[model samples]
Target: MKDTGWIAATEFVRHPSMVGSAFPASARMVRRMLAPLDWSNIKTLVEYGPGSGRFTFEMLRRMRPDAQLIAIETSQAFVAKLREQCDDPRLVVVEGSARDVRRHIAAETCGRADCILTGLPFSTLGDAEADIIMHETALALKPTAVLAAYQMRTAIGPLIDRNFAQVRRDFEWCNIPPCHLYWATGPFKAPKTARLHLISSR
Candidate 1:
């Protein structure tokens, strides 16, 4: 089997539409994205666009022993690789789009997810597709559950604000091209109308 980096590059070359980034997320980026999460309360976690299982591995390492992780990937090759490499009974790798997060979670697990993480590039997706994914992700998460997503650009902030009750933005500079990390919580009765507040990481 080809190494993950090679596979990621090849996948990007072959299907840019499915695989958003040319490289897998760096370890630093993954850590920054998962930093504020409260692992004890997370029983069911869903990861969208888990390219090369970088974040998947990190989540499994720190998550509770009985916790379940559902990895939703659009790339068949990456999905196969995750199944082969991760080998954890708690991990469920599904080949699909983020737009069907609610369906995937319901089919794979008992209830809604406690958290959803993504490194998907919303800018590359069409407006309708992005909207569907954003709404579905919000629906899949339990009340007070968090959604953590990291992107190279900041364009998706407004869409996130529309879905979640509160949004907190942070920056991580350790990666090749740093990332904008958004940590959002809630599916409250009325979503917040506040703008994203950017905070610099120490």
Candidate 2:
């Protein structure tokens, strides 16, 4: 079997639109993206395009024991590799497009995700496709949930801004090519039944 790096490189060569980046995210990049998360309170987590499981491993290590992680990957090779490498019951690797996140989440879990992390390169994706994925992601997340993503280019920043009520930007230069991190919340309306006091308390 080929190693993860080799597999990732091959996948990128074959499907540049899908893979996006030339390399998987560095450990430092993954750490920075996850730094603001409250692992103890996260019950359901969703990951889009978890190529080679770099960030997946870090997320699993830090998340609560009883928490569940749903990794949605369109590449069969990457999906198979993740299943083989990770044996944790908390993980469920699904082979599908990020645009259909809502369906996958509904089939795999009962609750809306507490957070959605992505490595999807909107720069490589067509505007329509990226819009659908972003819209679906917004719908899949709980009202207070977050969306975190890292990209080598800032072309996707405007699209993210349109989808979320608030956006925070950060950068990490330790990675090979460096990347910009975007943290976003809301733009999705809260349930009518949701109490203002409870929402304000969190």
Candidate 3:
């Protein structure tokens, strides 16, 4: 496996808005973010912003042999590098935006996802983009499906809370700039007017 630490660092320097973080998650933080999942039951998983595929490979390792993971990423460099480095039959690398998560999930699973995880920087994406991603995520999941996201702050928590009935917040101080990890479940269909109200209020 190729080491992506330097690749990720270069992308972060070139595009802070796109990369979200300066480094891939530490092994300890990755463990905590994933500890909430029932790995045995995750048949279809989706990951947003899988920079250099740090979390992608780990999830693929723990998933069932027949399970699939769809990794959606926006950075061209990361996407190309991931496709080059990963040969896992179960992994589908999509070069796209998380705002269109529903389409990506449908194209692969043809059903609801068992779990979705993200390292997206919602804080920099504005309320509207975050709302859209959250809403689309709900539409793409089965009931009680998990959405695990780590951000630099809790501002994204309210947006996530609006889409899911249950949301738990954890802090991982071992990471660069620290991280606010949210494990959310039981997605609710977002009201048609929710996004407009939230965006306009800000």
Q: Each prediction's Cα RMSD?
A: 6.5, 6.2, 3.4
Instruction: Please report the candidate that would top lDDT against the real structure.
Output: 2
* Ranking of all candidate structures by their lDDT, best first: 2, 3, 1
Q: Least accurate stretch of 10 residues (summed lDDT) in model 2?
A: 187-196
Q: RMSD in angstroms, candidate 3?
A: 3.4
lDDT per residue (tens digit) for residues 137-161 in model 2: 8889998899999988897787777
User: Candidate 1 or 2, higher lDDT?
Assistant: 2
User: How high is each candidate's TM-score?
Assistant: 0.91, 0.91, 0.91
Candidate 2 matches the true fold with a TM-score of 0.91
User: Candidate 1, residues 1-202: lDDT per residue as tens digits?
Assistant: 8788888999989877657678778888888888899999999999999989889999999899999999999888888888889888999999988898888988987888899998888877877787778877887888979999998888679779788878899998887668899999886433333223322322
lDDT of each: 0.85, 0.87, 0.86
What lDDT does candidate 1 reach at residue 85? 91
Residue pairs of candidate 3 with colliding backbone atoms: none
Residue 69 displacement in candidate 2 (angstroms)? 0.6
